[model samples]
Target: MKNSKKLFRIMTMCLMIVMMMSVTVFAEGEATEYVPKLYSTAWALVPPVVAITLALITKEVYSSLFVGIAVGGIFYGGGNFERTITHVLNDGLIGVLSDPYNVGILIFLVILGAMVSLMNRAGGSAAFGRWAGQHIKTRVGAQITTIILGCLIFIDDYFNCLTVGSVMRPITDKHNVSRAKLAYLIDSTAAPICIIAPISSWAAAVTGFVPGEDGLSVFVQAIPFNFYALFTILMMLGLVLLKVDYGPMKLHEDNAKKGDIFTTGARPYAYNEDDGKKENTKGHVLDLLIPIFSLIVFCVIGMIYTGGFFSGESIVTAFSNADASVGLALGSFFALVVTILLYVLRKALTFKECMDCIPEGFKSMVPAIMILTFAWALKAMTDSLGAAPFVEGIMKGNAEALMNFLPAVIFLVGCFLAFATGTSWGTFGILIPIVVGVFSNDHQMMIIAISACMAGAVCGDHCSPISDTTIMASAGSQSDHVNHVSTQIPYAATVAVISCITYIIAGFTKSAAISLGFGLIAVLGTLAFIRSREKANGTYIE
Candidate 1:
């Protein structure tokens, strides 16, 4: 596989170089603004598509992302060698890395890692696990508690992903749940719950993008028809309640039951010994709860702070304008300080012991950090090539002909765009306006169409390996990133397929009651078939 990827890179790079040298200049023409032939065309989406496809196939995100970035540079640079190099370096990598928001997220990631390390060193995680093991006797209870915590943290997906994962990982681990399964749970709850929640950042983003309409009102109406999100919630409960497993997730879970939680030997993360040492036996349930609660409180305050809550905006308006990256970084930073101080005051860990966790936490987060940086850089390449405009054009161009099938079509488009770009917010931001323009407010399918758009974005982001929430989920669960992505994709894809069908039903019926009822039936029916098949094949886990 490595050799093939290397060969592919060599050939593609050579082809790009040859193309660069072979192009002819129009010396006869007067000076004009330079424009790449691929600009705003369907080809604009090719780079991200290539990246996403290769990442899934190769199981190597870094090289896949770089290849995609190079492809985008080729498209944008128009076969100019010097320009391609300059564009890839200056406009792509540096541009994204230098963005204040991106930097803030990286900082937050590192800080969150440090705090998690400190908590471990203080024995908070171990203590919580011991407590949960006694009270949460069944695996179903452990999974349900994780889901509930994830739902409660709906203010932001990133927050939900990390907080739920950190708090629940110990409990899940004790019950022999695979890290991959934990990641799937964290990820499924993160975006799916947030996208549907009325008071979430996702809600704020959706509202801000819809022009000339009351965004919140539309969001509220569309909630019932958000088949993907709602069905996903149902799917998770069914998985836990029925105690069934299928797909790649089943393999991991089966292995976990044998005591190999990871199912693979690839060691991406190095555990901190500070947490396991004999020096710290003073950990308590409050040691974990206080810091986690404090982090949540400070993070919320930080978000409102950024939105100028003190400066005069209403709560909704403030949320709409809040800088999540900045707020999270700020909130986590302060939260870390409070945790360290609390540990020191409680004599759980010395001041120096808490301070020592800073570097340890940073080390743990390095994998996620690298993946996020590359993903951001790749997104930048796509942006520079005008992928957003290209996507918007596709949505607008086919609207008239696909009117009856608009909801399904929009859902598919939303899935593809969000999957390629690894961002649900950006996908919806691009499509929501086009959907609005195509269907008037009075149109029967208008709200349904909008719901399809939101559902698809969340579905795509839920599966995309490069998504920040996905990355956060892996970090939170302390799972191998690729393992989490690979195992979760099948599960996410199942929900997406059912969701697409539900959208078709919705398009025709234009009624949430009929659409939602059929959607629920379809999901439950599919799961029953899977379970029966597993039992028939003698492969059922139980």
Candidate 2:
């Protein structure tokens, strides 16, 4: 397709998503206390439906998000009247920005943008690609690389999806690996890793949405109960060892083996296509490694500082109390400064050239910033309508009946919501109120429930055709969307099953370590069995 058509479609989609989100936000804020229960639930979830509709129609992420935001705003604006426009501005836009949680996410994203820019300018991404390319020779190796990289970059899912996808795409492609497979790998690892990782931005975002609990401390406690994440990671590891080909995933592998390749979406920066294009133009590989190392080192130190690590506080306590945005921003700034120095010293370009990369880096993040802003608007709208109270009431009641199966049930529900809405954060936000209210007294059960919520959302979002991570993963791998979704479901489900079992055991034992350890053993045993069977058949995909 022509660039103009693509751009037009993209803009149209964004407008739709924006409109839906705006309606939702505005409607909730202006909703009357006497509003009907059914109407309120419809109002609360309208953005997601609109988002999916736009995505399916436009086949674009930004467009879908924009439309979702707009629908949310319209709902909040009350029947899409002109008079409600003022409310959207005052209540939706202002409210979203003023939110402490939203503000933190914005700051974190902006800084992440800067850091990514520095990484690109410093050649860190390319360096990582070069390093990964040398070792990942087989399909199993590719899957493992994607999983490990996803786990390593637990600071944020957005960062993980984009960066890992960018770095690994070339290697995966070279091995005749399907773009769909690569997308699966990226999506699978993205949220699952963040949901489990204590210091990540997902934790920060989820913590912010939770009420009546110290956002940070609650997250720390919640980590132990996050059985979905623990199990998902194990599943990834199991897939690597066993190489089990099942369901749609098996067909995808078969297609890939036959060299069937398909790709869609806008060609954003043309960054993923050719690895060697800038190799000689860029400085030595260390130019990349140094900036990345510095970025990681400083980010950790920064998180520590915000948490007041040396002030005689516990590590978990410090993390919970830390100013995450400031920490992430400062760390990114530090990396940027270091990147410039490296560029100058290496004579890769003049000072002017070095300075030019900053804006260029930020330019790449415009899409992310826009989508995030719209998402925030949707959140504000839903909250204003008292969506949380209703959801909490329902989930809490349901939990009473299924407390014994809370882990598995929450996992399933989380996945369903995320798949339908195309957002793990939204799923997490909606579920938190329910989980918190239901398991407030039972700390053990609460942990299990919350973990399942986070994990289940990630798992479903990882493979869902509509999910942004799924889209980005496909875009990064330049793969077909249906192909990716079809192939990944089985592997994800396998993990889901094991993860559910682990959560049940954890609830009884109230021990995270034992549950995780025993769960890993079970996953490995499952993998070994699959491997032995595959060897016997000699036709994994078939």
Encode model 2's per-residue lDDT on 1-542: one tens digit a residue.
Answer: 26645755665676566555544432334555534343447457666666655554455656566555655555555554442465455666777678775575555555555545555555666666677667666777877777888779887565566667656765676666667667777776777777767677677667776788777766778776676676667676666566665666665566666775343344454452343443443546677667667767777677768878889878766666667566766676687678778777777656886666556555655555555565555555555555556555667667778876777778887876676556787778888778888778886677667777887888778756556566556544546544565567777777778887887777677787888887788878877887778778886652
The 10 consecutive residues of candidate 1 with the worst lDDT sum are 21-30
Candidate 1: where are CA atoms >4 Å away?
1-34, 272-275, 441-444
**What 10-residue stretch in candidate 2 is worst by lDDT?**
272-281
**Winning model by TM-score:** 1
The parts of candidate 2 lying over 4 Å away from their true place are 1-39, 53-58, 87-136, 198-225, 244-262, 265-276, 310-313, 416-447, 460-494, 497-542
Tell me the lDDT of candidate 2.
0.65
| True lDDT of residue 352, candidate 2 | 80
Best by lDDT: 1
Estimate, for each residue in 239-300, the C-alpha lDDT of model 1 and write its tens digit. 98888878889999899888888888754774643355633556898889999999999898
